[model samples]
Target: MIRTIPKPKKSKRHFLWLLGMKLMISSLLIFFFMSSCTKEGTISLNNTNDNIGAEIADSITVRTATYQLDPLPANGKGIMLVGEMTDEATGNLKASSYFRIGNSAISSVTLPDDAVFDSISLALPYQGYYYGDTSLTQSFTLHQVTEEIKLIDESNAWEEDEKPVFGSGSTLFTNNTFRYDTNPLGAISFKPKPTSKTDTVFVKLNQMFGEDLWTKVKSGSNQVTNSEEFLEYIKGFVLIPSGKTPALTAFPTDSILMNIYYSYTRTADGKKVQENLQMKVDDTTHQFNSLQIDRSQSLLSALKPDAEGELSSDQTKQQVMLQGLSGLVTKIQFPYLHEFVNRNDVIINKAELTIETPPSSHTPYTAPSTLNIMLADEHGVPKSLLTASYETTTQAAYLVNDLSGGTRNSTYTFNLTEYVSNYRGAMEDTKSSLYLTIPVSDLLTKADRLLIAKSDDSLPIKLRILYTKY
Candidate 1:
């Protein structure tokens, strides 16, 4: 036999309703006080409380992981990056730029018999872009490509969102490389002056190499007469940096020129006249930077080049990383979010995320000026970029500078109110994680990187939420 209990009387029910009202009023006051202390922004609500509750929480659990992105398309971007560096964050890193050279002026070129070839040199103009230590002297060698600088045709290489804005065509990626002669044509060592617009570094080629090309032009060889044959003979050029460089530098592809100098006797006056021929970089579409990153000596060693996987922040010393130029990106997730989903009593008002950098993380390198946050699938592939409220533009988190001596003051923050509200109503399977990456415009041209501390008490990442319960 079981005993049944009777329902409460009307007076008692009324008393409980009054009690809930009191609790709601108290919670509202607490929430308001906390919000005022934060001084970030104001929270407003109706003056009357009708059986409703409010909550302010900053203890939400956030998970973080890091993974490598696919090879980035590096062709026709107007910038050529070349360098080599070794650091604990990215391990041994190397960058090389490959591009073909051609000149239409050579089509009608004729040389006199008395003309004598002078020295030939390659002129590289800097674009004021650099990473790592510029105080040290940087050294690199110019090599001749043994094979043609050709691109492989891939019909389905780019996804809809990953397609380049410049239009679609066969392009080269950071992982693509061409065979180059082991012997370099020329090499140079100099202190970098990236910010000087008028400064140009010139590397003189071997006399034999210059004379061979000079002789060909004088004899009107087929190799020097047509673009097709010219490319077949000279192939292309690759800028390879010595392993000793601690910085990566960028040069404008269009400004690169190969100059051939010569002197000829004037038939009428017998005066010696000097002249030079210029060969500009050809087919900007086929130019690309080949990047190689070795993580064997760093925390990311577990990430294999041939495998797709992610390493948790716990496994990486409670930190996640985001790097440009096909390097790495961080993923963020809320594991216990399901506990509050679909709750009829709760109404999420605002959600803000803050990610901080570790101490000394900015010593030798500066963090990216801005970062883009995107919704990502389980495999870490970006699905859609998170956008501003009621706007079609993608949202970006700008880095806040630190005035104090401490490096931890620098941070990246995001407004995730819309996402939080949607997550509360969406099905568990449809919910996605957030990915923090460098801006798309910087991926193939810049080597900016960021290191974010994982979420924890007194740590680098935090999420705060203001909500109401009814």
Candidate 2:
């Protein structure tokens, strides 16, 4: 039976088997295609530009940026400039090559290369320039050349040196260097001389003498004579017992004396005579009698006694008889009266009366007189004249009574005791002159008022005085 069925449809069965094998082959082919499409590669686009060269072309131009260089360092050293272009070549766009600039050059110079540019335009890996090693990247610009900075030259701060020539511009300071040249301003002064004490004294003494009385005398206007002048005028009168009259002759010398004389009278012609007067120097008992009349026999008799009776009665008797007879005859012969019948009257009587009279009854008379005397030493020491002696002469009395009256008789006696005693006392206590009184009236009356025989006078009165330096 199998045989018979196969035969009828074998063609359809074959068609179906072939269609199943085709379907399996198609499935395997699809699996192999999927595996090949999913496999990984060794070369990456991020690793190299050649791997993605065309792909990154737009980013390359857009990423790059321009840059400027930094100014040079101090002292003309170089400075650096860095930017982004060189960052890509090294796979680090933020850190790239830099350029250096110096003072002498106007442009920036690239490090690791001598390439220079008018201005630095560089790329840096970073957005801005930062510190980095020179080998990595650097750039710099040249600084302009300039003069060095200097300090100010103030006058207060200046200093000097021996090596330099300093001018007016030089400054002053407190070291050994400089000093102040101008001196301070203004003026100067001085003092005067002195005087002496001796010169002052001499001037005062000269002024004193100018106003003195002696100055007037020297000028010849002697209105009144002074004591000094009177003393000088009497220089000749002063006695010099020391024999120094030559020395005393000078003015105001050791001794001086002065004398003045004056005459006083009542009548012009009434017997102008001097009598009964005396004088003594320095109140002495010495009498200077009859200085005008030199003869004084009666005075000598009164002073001395009758020694050896040389004045006895017998001797006196014969003397008086002879003198009386001569006096009587002489009186009768001159100016005689004729009515005398008595020629026998007294001629018989006078000779007889004398012979009858005794000599013992007769007494001698002394005349009154005056004198002034002075004595002094060389130094004007007054000398006493109390014990000194003096004498003078007597004059005859005129008859005034008539003989008819039984011969009116008269007798006179002189006493010198009171005069001597009073003068002795005056000298004892005196250093100068004594005063004497002369009886002008008494002497005139006793002389019968005769013309030449009446009046008495005095002379040359002086005073003795002592002088001493002490």
Candidate 3:
């Protein structure tokens, strides 16, 4: 999917920019040398002037393209994401989660002989993470997973380094899927109150389904005797989004609960009593989301993931895309860095990369709180995270919101002084580039997306540098 470009011919404007920079540096050097000349026309090389340093330049050229990476490993992320949303730039995306149910008390469920089963319900607690238009009601179906929700073959899971951090023993990616019963056990439709801590969405399961489980426990069958036996009897569940859900919502795995309701006869008091059997998520390491992105109807439709994966900003309305769930990422290349290296007289002091989004694009969906920059090889494969100076932690570009009740000044900035200083040597690999992406944790778990304007837009991406002449 990766292609290399030949060195492009410099345009007239590029030539002029370099010429102007050289002239400014030459003027400064001449002024300093002339001032240090002695009476006999001998120049004094010793100079201790602290004020003569670092000039700022914000005109460096940055080329951008939308690049697609391989599917991300997504199992056991603490949260479960589900729903579907249509995006104008990257097309439609749908998210679904698969999880198993287990309870240590299943074996000890000793219901009264006179107890009668009622119904069952599944409850999901919100994690407050949302994307797309939330004004409309959201809907999805709950299906019983017919097949065991276990990892694919361990040997085929992932590269050793790319294994899921929370997987039980193997790994699962966004591309992995499990089979579920054709008929839904339950379904739900409601307006989401993601911010309300106490608000929860519940789906009432079919009476027959609840009765079957209750009957097993009441009869003391081996299927309901122990947690391991229970898993074999009922594999798991999958939350499948309806065709036109307005937004994607998130739920914490630890808070998901399923309950079976029933009424029992109290012989001593001659009264009826109510009781319920509760089930919680069995293994957090086995829970995962299955994400599908359909870019067929958007500008990204032209991207070919297996061969020639890059879609230039020029072809995308002068904008690049950054999305989570391994959908798309923006690749950046410095086409004019050679001009700075050729002079060799100036030392790079500071370099900042500024990225902006058009205010008009901001709708109910907001940008991600942070983005990551990664170093890529000649083949466009991510190599390592770009980190802060003298630190192992990855350097992230934090979103700076526009405070005027409008998103006019929204931007993300990164300090690339170290990177720009060594860009000359990095040029050895002609196709080396930097990728702007969401954090790995979010990329594998959330559905957030962002659009970055290119150089032709009103608020285009820019790389500003501060240099000091020797």
Rank by lDDT (best first): 1, 3, 2
The candidate that wins on TM-score is: 1
Q: Lowest lDDT 10-mer window, candidate 1?
A: 39-48
After TM-score superposition, the amount by which residue 449's alpha carbon in candidate 2 deviates from its true location, in angstroms, is 14
TM per prediction: 0.85, 0.13, 0.83
Model 3, which residues run further than 4 Å from truth? 1-53, 153-155, 160-169, 226-228, 304-308, 336-339, 403-409, 424-427, 455-459
- Report the C-alpha lDDT of model 2 over 3-108, residue by residue, as the tens digit: 5545465688798899888888888756543332222122222332232221211111101011101110111111111121111111111111111111111012
RMSD of each: 7.4, 91.4, 13.8
**Model 1: pairs clashing at backbone N, Cα or C within 3 Å:** none
The per-candidate count of clashes, in order, stands at 0, 34, 1
Off by over 4 Å in 1: 1-54, 156-168, 267-269, 338-341, 454-457
On a 0 to 1 TM-score scale, where does candidate 1 land against the true structure?
0.85
Task: Write one digit per residue (lDDT tens) for candidate 3, span 1-470.
Answer: 89988998999999999999999999987876444321111211222235765366777778899988776667888888999988788788888999988865567877788889888999998999888887888888999988777776666764555433323356787877888898999999999888779999999998889888888878888887766778888989999898696589999998899988889889999899998888888688789999777778998998753233788888998888988885478999987786675466765556778888866666656788899887877666677888974358889989888888874758988877667767654444447888888886577777788887643445377887666566
User: Once model 1 is optimally superposed onto the true structure by TM-score, how far is the C-alpha of residue 465 displaced, in angstroms?
Assistant: 1.8
Better of 1 and 2 by TM-score: 1
| Deviation from native of the Cα of residue 96 in model 1, angstroms | 0.9
